[model samples]
Target: MDNTGFSLASLLVVTALGLLVPLIVTRIRAVRIPIVVGEIIAGVVVGKSGFSIIQNSEWLQFLQFFGLAFLMFVSGLEIDFATLKPTKVRKGNRYARFLTMPPVFATFATGLTFVLSYSLSQVLFNLHFIKSPLLFSLILTTFDWLWFF
Candidate 1:
């Protein structure tokens, strides 16, 4: 791919279309999913898994990397660390228990899911390009503060 593929127009138009199509899908009354999931679906559809239509240039990948890092930082900031403190009155308080549930839940769920469907021919499975199912599960279960306020 030519370096010229990283132009601002290409980046903005493609990203906008990817996001916009999902937004449009969410407009249907029966479709209750969030825009973020829609964007993910759109990405998979256009990505190497579906059509191999969009080849991400290094610049685009870098931008996505930066955005993900910033989003994760923001999500971490939103966490109320005070709620996580151990309390004597309660063996495990509500907030603390709630915080613990996701990691435990994700661990079991991702492990089971991965164990059940871990095989795919290198030709059909695009996620194998990442080479680590553990990393994929972590990425999948990462908090989507993007979904909440």
Candidate 2:
């Protein structure tokens, strides 16, 4: 099939699954999951990894790129500006813990996690997704505390 035709079909199927699967899952309450994660599950079910309904092509990459941009835009919109400002707090308190934990502890933790994951990926098995230990480390280090509250 042509790129345009395949892209459109893929987009339609993905959009439908992305919208429907999350709604169904939330309604069923079969283990609460994030919508984005649900969408990813839907994608995997239809994509090359699952049913092989769609192939990973350059056309699909364009869609993925645009979808990522859209997701980032939505995340930016969700950010609370007030949270960006520093607040006065006592030393060695809960707030102090939150403030210090990510930068100080996460740095060492992320490095260690990267090395371990990389070694495991190399020695234990060659997994396609765990190809980039640095990227995995960055994901681990970038702690979004806002998600808790």
Candidate 3:
């Protein structure tokens, strides 16, 4: 692949088109696809796979981290303890619901991730290794406090 064609204008055009195409497709189909999916596809298009316009750019990595941090900060700002007043159902039920969902979801996700990791490891490495499953399970079990809002 020739790297000489890469330039600022080419990069902007590819990035813009990457963002635009998914929205256009979603609009035409009248389907609601998440912005994150669109953004990831945009990254893949501009990265190594599609146009290779901005392959392995450090700037993109920084921007990704910035986005994540900004999201987390905004999420943290939205949640307030005063907002969680439960109706007269039962004692501590409101607190339980708020606290329980995250761990439950995290646990379910971890289990699913571990199963997938184990299966992939066994298939690809041709070895009956169990370390990856436990590691992946723990990794997936973590919950972002910012996402709790």
Best by TM-score: 2
RMSD, candidate 1, Å: 7.6
CA lDDT of 58 in candidate 3? 50
Which ranking of candidates, highest lDDT first?
Answer: 2, 1, 3
lDDT of each: 0.62, 0.68, 0.59
**Structure candidate 3, residue pairs in collision:** none
- Per-residue accuracy of model 1 over 1-149 as CA lDDT, tens digit each: 55446566547755786658776976857646675567667777876687766766767778678867976897788897665554344465766565465555556766765554444322224744656655555555553544444
Candidate 2: residue pairs that collide: none
The number of residue pairs in model 1 that clash at the backbone is 0
Q: RMSD for all candidates, in order, please.
A: 7.6, 5.8, 7.3
> In candidate 2, residue 69 scores what lDDT?
99
Residue ranges of candidate 2 with Cα displaced over 4 Å: 1-12, 55-63, 91-149
Candidate 3 overall Cα lDDT vs. reference? 0.59
Give per-model TM-scores.
0.46, 0.57, 0.44
TM-score of 1: 0.46
